[model samples]
Target: MSSKFAQNRSFKKNCTAFAAFFIMSVSYCQTSTYGQFWNEVQFNRTINAKWSTELNLGSSYSSTETSSNIFENNIQKSFRGWGHYYLSPRWKISSFVAYYDNKDVPEIGQFKSPEWRFALQAIYYFHKTGYTLSTRMRMELRHMRNGDDDYENVLRYRQQFKYLQPINSKILRKGVVYGIASDELYFKSGTKVTGLSFFDRNRLVVGAGYLFTDDIQLEFAYANEYLPRDNENQIVNAASLTLTFNNLLPNLNKKLLHKNEANTNED
Candidate 1:
């Protein structure tokens, strides 16, 4: 297990180095939409027979449109705290609150416009495996505050439908695993000068992981996203790695069996 995990770490480091070199060598024109790159620290704790909680914290830095002529480096920090309720064997309900920021770093004395989004999600499981279908509705409030510019209340609605399928090993003990996901995002309020009038953003991600033990899984992924507006479109390519430690590993097997029995009884 340790050897497999070490190999996975080596792979992640190599991928990160390649991505960094590729981006620095080229000059990107137009707008770039980068997917989140920070490592995720997530743990799941079962509270009772029907309730569970997930906590996550992550951060990322990327390049974005600075102004009309230049580009500014952007950084985003995301913290997520969510709860899941098992309504039935195949049905579940989850909700999360996320904070996002779009900051301008080049301009002197420039402030940041942070956005807060609250989302309620519903998920349906296919079987004992990880195959699932998810629908999410997010209500967003963007507070655009700057030292030089004053903007009004930005209210937006975002809805997404996603499908998740496992691409790696099915056995948890083997450690090497992958999940492929795709989603379509719809935006209501147009952004500032980017001239975005209701765009379609589609994302494809491949998550690869190697488990060190029942308690720890080290993961890496390559993701791409395309957002097309009326005339202009933004393209993004991002790579990231995460190390997940399952604090409640001793209970996972018991819970898995319980979850399986629940599904069987429902069936």
Candidate 2:
């Protein structure tokens, strides 16, 4: 009886999240800045408890302002890869690079330079609710060209606060369902000396996650973004999907835990 009740509750929560996302998408789609739609998938694998890596593949399209039609733009392909390391239980760091190749759409015209970026990041963990809470900080160097001109160099900082809350504790023995949300702010690293403005971009995301096991999880969400190049009044909405796999090194986590326990015992 209790198990069935919990399942019912989980279903309600999932439906609520989806409904809210749908409403937000519809409400925002009416504006000129809102026609950009995106779908993406990501994979993450752990080399061990201490090291992990990621790959993300995605595509995006935007409607022409004049036509205001749905899904009218050509697809933009993206590739991203990163590696993360656990320094300790509470701290970790990552470095990543990404590339984007956007095809010519009548509305946006051709962009000469494919955009690419390299960044280093650090995350601090403070809480665990089955779904964890953490903050991430990153510094990025972006390389891009709009035309025949030289590549513009921009240094950016991004800070994000994230929450992951589990829905069904009983079911967590085999799998778990959770809610996740995060907000990120971007800032230019320098202003007077670098001649770059302080503000750059911002992003907000909300979604739910399901963990099939400690080894695998998937997340689906909606993202709203404010880009510096786009009109200030416009907000771009994107759909996001991510998958995570852990323990690629098999017994490495167990070995590490055992080793740590042994060290503590000796002390």
Candidate 3:
């Protein structure tokens, strides 16, 4: 009952945040300044020593105005499930199925985009020292529907490279930092579209994370983005706090109690 209540509260909180985001976005539609906020709730489990499954729920809201009279706002909500399989100790393959919706206008708002994404990744690890080189190739199946218009399906691809380095190891041990660079390419292949052209989007991401224990972790990340559709570059700031459980959730203070008992036995 307590767990159910807690989940209900969290759902309500997320809804409230989404509502606030919409309000703020609409209100700032006529200004040059823009703001966006996003949140993600993720869960993952190891399917085997080399395979894993991950689930993610994410929401975002953003607003911008090209001029005093022209305003644009965006709201997105997505849920994704993915499977990751390691080909080698430092190389992996990933496939994902996702359902996403974008809200563009207030009157007849909502565009559905269900996509399937696949990726291959390579990671190079340094001996003893905490560092890694990461590279990836990504492809996606994009289904887009706008208002009453017929849906269109398309294919998109991206290539990315990143460097991961350890930052701090005390208190929050396993602290690491990353520098990422990515380029996105789109392929227009469908029955409903005319001219086919490639659009490129670039991003830079930097972040740090810590492993509190084997079962718990926290991370914060920030990104800068450039999209071909928008004339002005955008900046994104993000933060996350995650809790990972191996089998089931454990009581946080159980280790302290066990340590006390062991000391008593020793005395």
Measured by TM-score, the strongest candidate is 2
Worst 10 residues of 2 by lDDT: 104-113
**Candidate 1: global Cα-lDDT?**
0.62
TM per candidate? 0.61, 0.68, 0.61
Q: Give the per-residue lDDT digits (tens) of candidate 3, residues 1-267.
A: 999999999999999999999997666543233345556767777777898888877776554444222223446777888788887776678888887766652212334433334333343433245555566677777666644566666676666666655555312243333332333333434333212335534656666555655555555556555433222223333232334343222343676778999999999
Give the 10-residue window scoring lowest on summed lDDT in candidate 1.
65-74
Q: List the residue pairs that clash in candidate 2.
A: none
Question: How badly does each model clash, as a count of residue pairs?
Answer: 0, 0, 0
Residue 78 deviation, candidate 1, in Å? 1.9
- lDDT per residue as tens, model 1, 1-267: 999999999999999999988885553333545434555677777788899888787766555454332123446667778888999987788887777564642211235756565666676555546555666565555555444465534555656655555456554654545564546565656645223466545666666667776667777877677766444456766676776655466566778999999999999
Candidate 2 vs candidate 3: the TM-score winner is 2
Instruction: Give the winner by lDDT.
Output: 2
lDDT for each residue of candidate 2 in 113-152, tens digit (9 for 90 to 100)? 5668899999999865466789999999877544554566
The CA-based lDDT of model 2 is what? 0.72
